[model samples]
Target: MALSPEDVIKKSFSATHLRRGYDETQVDDFLDEVVVELRRLVSENDGLRTDLEDCRASRGVASGQGAAAPAAQGERHEDAEDTQELEALRRQLAECQEARAAAERRAEEAQERVGAAERERDEARSSLEAASAGAAVGASAAGGDGEDPSSIISLAQRLHDQHVAEGESTRARLIEEGDTYRTTVVAEADERSAELQRTGQETHDRLVAEGQATHDELVQTGQSRHDELVQTGQSRHDELVSTGEQTRDRLVAEGQASHDQMISEAEQQRSTVLEDLHGQESALSATIGGLQSQERDLRERLRAFLSDQMERLDGSRPTS
Candidate 1:
């Protein structure tokens, strides 16, 4: 099974401790790095596995053609070498399968971690709501006694300050996570490129060696089988290279398209959010203005009532 980021981090820490002394904060930072690297590695591994599978399928078709060709002089001998190559390819395929499985497991674990993070975020939101509600209640109670307007205003200010602080903290955490994720993705891409280059080189060497062997055997026999093998090998090699390049190009184009789609979606969402915010602001302003108008009317009515009472009291105090 694939190792999770946490598992990878834990393993790294354990190994590091055995080799060196323990430092809690350092270990924690290292673990964070490990998680980033492990996620990158898993992503690259998945891509590599997909490419390898495509290569193998292409190779299978070439192998079928190679088998159908007539057995010429020393062709039987070449068959043994071909068998060896096939076995090697099988081994490589098995290794790729194992790696793919590991990567899939790691991906599942990563998803779980993401789900947990989402849950935590939800909990934090709930906590924030509760805190805001509590603050509102406190402010209402304080305002009920008109003698402490200053205290009520102070409480409201404190609530605003707390909310701003919490928002800043959340934004900082998101920024840090984004940075780490970007770094990890870049590293993973580099690693995958290096691996692909190495694999390509090895495949090229094997094909060259096979061609040389066939050419030598054909030299001793004559032009018929030699020309046939050379032609077949060249054709197959060209086909594989062309097809692989086209596939790679197509994948790249698809990826770019997907990225563009995501960007467009994000822009749309941002625009929607901004529009909603603007609407909310307008509504809030209107509500506040309405409330203020009502308060003014209420105050005027109170003044009229107090004035009338004072007039009555004045009338009651005769000759004053």
Candidate 2:
């Protein structure tokens, strides 16, 4: 089951309510680029298929005519030339298929990156939750301390969850877009190929009709034309492949860099939140210690006052 462009456009993610997450605009922009690149790849694939079909049809017609014609040394030489041309065409077609496969591989890689980012985000969220739970337990152990630290921890947890959720959502969206693009490109290529086949059949028939009288001359001319076309196609294919590779590399690099930056920032924020919590806990402990000291001093003072009063009372009783 392949996702189409419409599916990508309709894809949505769960909102991270009350949390800050990835920038929606940036995510959307990146998706748009993926769609555009997919479209370009599809178009190129279709064109390459058309060219391959044309070359095959041309070869078939040339072979059929050669079989019907008189076999001379010159004709044999021409046949050999035709065979070479067909071989070149086959090689070109193979190269085209390879290029298409490479493009698909790149799309898969993009999805893999999306998966990695999601995994990292999930890990971060889990770790933060664990840390928050730990802090809560420590606070409880310290005589069920005040709500301030707990509240702060709660807020930090929410923030962490929100950020992680946003990154996850963005990554999911990107994966969906890639799936959709791949499906759409393949379908379009198939349709274009069928159309090209029909067109090639009609053109082959016309060429056969035209070759009846001027077979030798046309063969020579066609060889020259075929050579020219093959060279041109090769050059064009090389340029397209080079450009596509460069674009893919740049996009992948940018995505990775962005992901790393986001993770680094999130870690820093979590560390800061933890530090604040620890500092507050220390302050509370010091205050409790001071209160205990004051309590002990008060107890000693009261006992001394009681002893003094008793002595005065004894002294006042003369008969005793």
Candidate 3:
């Protein structure tokens, strides 16, 4: 016969002829402890497996049961919140994208501005150079008049120096303005990018927290349902066993009564008793047959459940 964990714990083994076998008491204790732990693990494994199956089965039951309606409503509310959050996030992303586009446009505009500024500066320098040339021509003409030639030359030199200083000052101011505008544009772009990053991180964190909470709720609900199913199954099993025991006991008692009647009754009554005993035997057989059929059905269901479990486990197993 196949051994259950309990049987294994209770079993005794024949000693080896060579006196080379391990110590029996120690071995028995170890094996029994192992069996107990194994049974516990098996029970826990079965519970977890049942919980998963029940959870899968209950997916369709989200809104049906009375209490389930509230749960479903809560779930729907959560879903609504999630949808709203997602929509909000989408809007934020669109805004961020728009900001990025705006920044890009500004950068392009900044380049254009810089280019225009450079052109303006170049034009200013060119105008200054042209003016300087004109001034030089005027100074040369004045110096060439031959009246106090040295004084005329000195005055012309001073006027030329003033023109040169004015041109340099104007160029410096133009360059400074372009630098300031470029710096401002760059700083705005950096700030927009940073804002987008911060918003993205916040959205990620909110989604993660929501997902974790949902997971915990599902696990807790599944565990509660699993425990309920297990208890119901156990109660039904116990009831069936008790019914079978009662039927067996009644049959045995009737058989004893018939035996006594056969021993004490006359021939005619004995025949009647014999017929009653035959009827009782047939009933006992029927009861046994019924029990056997039920047992077979139970066994078949168990085998199917085990096959499904094995297949599920195999599919989930990781490959090296």
lDDT of 3 by residue, 107-215 (tens): 5665566566656656665666666666666767777565555554566566656665665666566556656755675576567657756876787787778767867
List the candidates' TM-scores in order: 0.29, 0.35, 0.37
Per TM-score, what order, best first? 3, 2, 1
> Order of candidates by lDDT, top first?
2, 3, 1
Off by over 4 Å in 1: 1-147, 219-320
| Model 3 CA lDDT for position 85 | 75
Query: Pick by lDDT: which candidate is best?
Result: 2
Clashes of 1: 0
* The 10-residue segment with the lowest total lDDT in model 1: 12-21
In the predicted model 3, the residue pairs found to clash are none
Candidate 2: what lDDT? 0.71
Instruction: Choose the strongest candidate by TM-score.
Output: 3
Q: Write the per-residue lDDT of candidate 2 for residues 217-308, one digit (tens) a residue.
A: 55664576567557877888899889978987997898899889877877777788789989999999999999999999999999999999
By TM-score, is 1 or 3 better?
3
lDDT of candidate 1?
0.63
lDDT, candidates in the order shown: 0.63, 0.71, 0.67
